[model samples]
Target: MEVAELKAIIEGLLFASGDEGITVKQLQKVLGISKETVDHLLEELKYEYERRDRGIMIMSSNEVLHLTTKPEHSDYYKKLLEVPQSSRMSQAALETLAIIAYRQPITKTEIEDIRGVKSDRPIQTLVTRSLIEEVGRKESVGKPILFGTSKEFLTYFGLTSLDELPPLPDTDEPEDINQEADLFFERFNDELE
Candidate 1:
């Protein structure tokens, strides 16, 4: 297929999928072309967008591609978008998260060591809520899955990255209490309450 036709097909895919984007490999595989050629075409498409000076553009991070409107268009999108109320994390989850964030990529056993209690439930809860995810597996005996915060966690905390986390003093060691209601309530600020 001609580059012009391929570019149009790519643009159509991006628009039709909304937030999701077709990757270079997907395009190359489907088009039966090398990634170098696909990448060159993507550059051509980017130039086309740049020349058009439209509010939408293709973006890629960690090899994930998507087409999103420019930040300047956020106000307009906000008129149609409503912020959903965020759910608060349990204190156990927060404590577990702190250990995970500060000492990560930490294992479940390590988190439990710092907290001095079982963290399975809180870890499971955090994973289930999409706040924490399996970053990798430990190279140790059991090869336990290491947990870390997700993009959702950052958005919930109003942070752009994990580096924005406030430093907790090492002296203020955490403990285990399976049903501590205060910890559950204190997981998030009153604004989230």
Candidate 2:
């Protein structure tokens, strides 16, 4: 493929990779090209982005490449973040968020076990809202998707880290799950206010 076409493809890949950036080896394998060619293309892409007035730029760290907004646009991003919460979360979503925050790296089945009800809709809503994301998959049969709070979740809650979350009380009964969720939500709302 031509250099322009190759660069376009690489841009698409970087954008799709999200926070988990793509590595040089992965790009080389995907393009079926030599490491040198991939490196050259990436350097050229970086140069082009730097030369032009682009809102997005390619970033590399730890030998991984990803596309992200330019630093100059951070003010706009902050303003966007300051927008009021579009809508209040449903009770089910709050419950799912509480469960995921306390017992993260959890799977759908585990969440269901704790709630004693189908959690698909709540999980979907959390994911859609970027509060929760698939951190990984379980190694057991079926390799179910493991869920966890995201950086956006921390930002939304005004927390510097997950360590700031209130310590969960010891409990084993499923019935107590709702109470725990309520308490967690109360703390979160207090922080928001």
The residue-by-residue lDDT of candidate 2 on 1-193, one tens digit each, is 9999999999998976767789999999999999999999998988888855778888889988889888988999999978866556778888888989988999999998988767877898899889999999999999999999999999888889999887666777656766876777866766655
Those runs of model 1 whose alpha carbons end farther than 4 Å from true positions after fitting are 1-86, 170-187
* Native-referenced Cα lDDT, model 1: 0.73
- In model 2, the clashing pairs are none
Q: What is the C-alpha lDDT profile of model 1 across 61-140, one tens digit per residue?
A: 77867777777678988976565535766677777876776667889888888777777778887887787899999998
* RMSD each, Å: 13.6, 11.2
Error of 1 at 41 (Å): 72
Query: What TM-score, computed on C-alpha atoms, does each candidate reach?
Result: 0.46, 0.52
User: lDDT of model 1 at residue 87?
Assistant: 72
Worst 10 residues of 2 by lDDT: 184-193
- Compared with the true structure, all predictions reach lDDT values of 0.73, 0.86
Provide the lDDT at 84 for model 1.
53
The candidate maximizing lDDT is 2
